[model samples]
Target chain A: MSDPGTITDSGSSGEAPVTMLATPIRLDYQYTAGLSQSRFLQGIAQGKFIGQRCPACHKVYVPPRGSCPTDGVATTDPVELSNSGTVTTYCVVNVPFQGQSIEIPYICAQILLDGANIAFMGLIQELPATDVRMGMRVEAVWLPKDQWGLTMASVKYFRPNGEPDADYETFKEYL
Target chain B: MADSEVLRAPHVLEYPYVRSVGPVIGAFLTGLRDGRILGAQSRDAQGKATVIVPPTEYDPVTSADVGALVEVGQSGVVTTWSWAPEPKKDQPLDRPFAWVLVRLDGATTAMLHVVDAGSLDAMSSGMRVTARWRPAAERVGRVQDIECFVPEAANP
Candidate 1:
């Protein structure tokens, strides 16, 4: 009934206590057949982007998928993508969440990796956290040659390519 | 692609969680199912007297071994509390409420539970309250069985 935030035990004398509630959250996930994310993940480990071409629809998918969204059928040949891409939309993560890396105030952006129809999710690096922007031409930062794995995180973050930033209209559709 | 129909779908689901409580808590629950309150003796260097339901495996402050579980009285004293003007989902009460940490008789630390008193003024630290158990037919192996606490007559 009284003020909810009032400290009733005002005279409490002891080490400041931090109440950690074990909040329980349950999640069950199911996967659908498309481009095998695992194989694409393997490609990223080797410092490459793989995409699949739908034989029926002729659309090229990035991170080579198992099937095409438009044709509703499995893709045949897998294609490797170029590392260069233009920045689309992005946010500067000034706030940190539990179990996060790279500290706070990092740039997470949508990158339209070259030779792919869809943009990929990645981080932007090298540039000051304040200098990131849309339409900036950025390139991938690969991991050490020996430490690559089957994960996109191998690319680390993209840094400014030092080229003229693309106009907003050029990369607007990628967002 | 313009004429393509978008069939949206959800991606995640849920499952039941089964918790395995240790011996002390196991015996305490056995007592509750048969209508009883339980507590454990603190075995820390301080050797403080503390009562805990679902008898804890170790002391709250120190990890010292607590004594065997024993039945304690159903009454308690409120310690600290917070009021929820608008209760959240799955809380004990559907209406406004006060979440109080009640130090049950013989317990050193407190346990959180809802207080069904009329208003804030009607509730205070050191107020005496008693357990209100769920209906006999609905009792399950869970904390909800204890329901909330209500004001009780002064200690005899």
Candidate 2:
């Protein structure tokens, strides 16, 4: 919070070994991932995408919030979703600010993975920002097994999967 | 694919924001680095001259443009205080300290700061205190340039 916020990190030998801003405050928390989410994150740790199916409505939610919003029923049924998905929407980042991990001219998209009813945010990469479009096909780019953790960082980012863009009519309900 | 046990994810919410404190606050912090306390001079509803330490760009009372950055007395009275018996790591003092709102002399408004009196019994409202500064070399432009306020000699 003080002058230390401006200090550029001195990395370790042979590595960028940096804690972005080690400063006046660092908060720690042991977050308990609920039943449905625990299973979802475990699947992510194994490079598998898992969604929970609602008992009544039957809608599948990846990274389930434990219950269905409509039916008010617990989503206990597990559904394994494919790594491939469609970019339901996207935004190109141009303006820059301090502490931004990504550079200018990058794309952030909401990806609706196949077999899941809801869409989630993902970073889109490996192509020019202008090429990105709504309903564009994309797939997960995962980190190595040793680098995998209980966090979403296991999947580095999503890139164009060479599949044709999905028709807007098929995803209009999700939009 | 589903695990019977709930997962425990260790999350660290790290918010490292770099913000521009703006011209008004910038001057005040710069003054602290130079071993001086500056207050923003403004007028109240009745046009009475009022000064505030750690000032805002606009007057707190009248919401008018402030006039000048004037030097104020380093010594001040603790308007109110809450004692931290077990200090947190990020606090100015690792040992016990009192978070005090000091109305620095010549300033109508009180500024929040810590008073490093020996113990809880040593702190009270209306107690006089003076700035304890870090060495000139160590004084970066920050509120912490003053290590912590200590009991003024006049206090009894």
Candidate 3:
């Protein structure tokens, strides 16, 4: 038998290089509540906006809270809310998130409802993206009356009220 | 983009939140076990008086220690507001509703909260509101213990 350890290069050959590949991953978060946010979820199941009040300051908070920002004590009362509001400031959500419901290039807006003082975040719908603007009067679109639940998704999205567009100066402060 | 041979694991990160409170906050929590609301004063800082639920022991801007802690009423007015058309897992009102900035009767500035009204007609600036407390059995040291505010009276 020939020598077991023998170098056999198949004629003329040069060294070859090595390479590696990678993939891009996105972030997805699922939240669980011990207590505070649970009330917000409860309200959504029934189709309502909830807020907490600071007993020290007497300020009512939307997305009702467990703790008051001022007094630091847990608020006791739970208040229900109206669904209508005005657009305060907003950004067009031309981009899309994984598992998103609305189509890409939709609008994500900040709306200031008539009675509440603070702003909550959410999406707008039913109207063309170009038609959305700050101070535009919009109304909530419920999830087909029977399908309501304890979540913000209870209201499908906001729709245009057909009023003339609000002046930019009127809502610039909210941005 | 698709490749049959590709295999990868996603990167994940978690961070802890560290919060420090001054004297007012300490007293405010003391009040919670007893069920009370306290607001701190801006002795060195000039501004309208405001109520603090958690009782900020120190002025946010001046960083001065607020010595005087006082009780606040449960009613207030909407200073400014916004709506959350959709809520995530644990917002106060699971349904669509507005978030408002409320300035209590004696306070100068505002705090945040949610309101429950069926439509825009149900809400307005200066609308009076009251706190809806959670049951005592559910009381924890946290904020959501109060729940969300509802309209005091039906809108005309």
Candidate 4:
């Protein structure tokens, strides 16, 4: 085959030479968390887990949102959620990326919290990577209260609780 | 609730890519690096000569290749402005300033930049303003090389 670079140069005869410049454009923004999410974060800071329930469908949502995705109605009911949950699915992370805080070969799992309809992702720790299973029971291992603030970072990571693996029937719909 | 505190968080958006400025825009940025401003020479629909700042490779109205590069005056007239009471992050100025559209002395079209007038009452259309270049060491081949614009009298 002819050289790949020469095939793309057919239009260069009439055009002027071009030069590329590199520049870094940095922008920062402050986002205001609205009513529903603000309440959830405040609860996390106080070592309490809060979720909102959809008024029509009654689906409990952790990390509460203003409106329900399923019924498209306002989620006005606030519900307290247990810190313990079942690991519905997980992935073994071996690849590296910029701004990644965790070490390689860690398990990132989707946790279906008790009393909530939706699942959220978090780092799974305090267990061997190979031992992490699809139906493992886990609980939020929180950081010291002095280190807590308005962030979910207060929960360092989720660890496997001594409870037995949740039955497949319990989290089948969540997958 | 009015009494409830609003929660805030920081977000950063970044584009990690390298771009080619092409011949016309490359020339303009090079001029900025050397402490000068260049405009593109073009013809309007009426075939009259015009110059545009932050030069474009093709004329915006006529869609024809710009004819030549011309050096333009540093001072200009503020054609319009809006007050930014609380400047957002990464804007040209950190303090309260005016976002202005200025028509340089020799250019027909306007360019956008911030003016560091102390207060909103100090800014108005038809005000004379001059480009304020960043220090020589901080000069990069980019539009931001000119840190901001200041009132002509304030610069002197």
Top-scoring candidate (TM-score): 2
**Residue A153, candidate 4: alpha-carbon lDDT:** 91
Write the residue-wise lDDT of candidate 4 on A1-175 in tens digits: 1121221133222232335677666668898888888988988999878999998889999888789998999897899999899999999998999879888889999999999998999899999899999899999999999888789899999999999999999999999
lDDT of 3 at A22: 23
> What TM value does chain A in model 3 reach?
0.69
The TM-score of candidate 3 is 0.41
Model 2 clash pairs? Answer: none
Docking class of 3: incorrect
Q: Cα lDDT for residue B77, model 3?
A: 85
Q: Which candidate do you rate higher for lDDT, 3 or 4?
A: 4
Off by over 4 Å in 4: A1-43, A46-48, A52-59, A66-81, A127-131, A162-164, B1-20, B43-50, B75-108, B113-132, B147-156
Worst 10 residues of 1 chain B by lDDT: B1-10
Tell me how large the interface RMSD of candidate 1 is.
14.0
Between candidates 2 and 3, the one scoring higher on lDDT is: 2
The TM-scores, one per candidate, come to 0.47, 0.72, 0.41, 0.68
Give the per-residue lDDT digits (tens) of candidate 1, residues A74-159.
87677788878888988899987755979778888888877777787788888788888888998888989787875565777788
TM-score of chain B of each: 0.81, 0.90, 0.74, 0.90
User: For model 2, how does the per-residue alpha-carbon lDDT over A106-164 read when each residue is reduced to its tens digit?
Assistant: 99999999999999999999999999999999999999998987789999999999999
Better of 3 and 4 by DockQ: 4
Clashing residue pair totals per candidate (backbone < 3 A): 6, 0, 85, 0
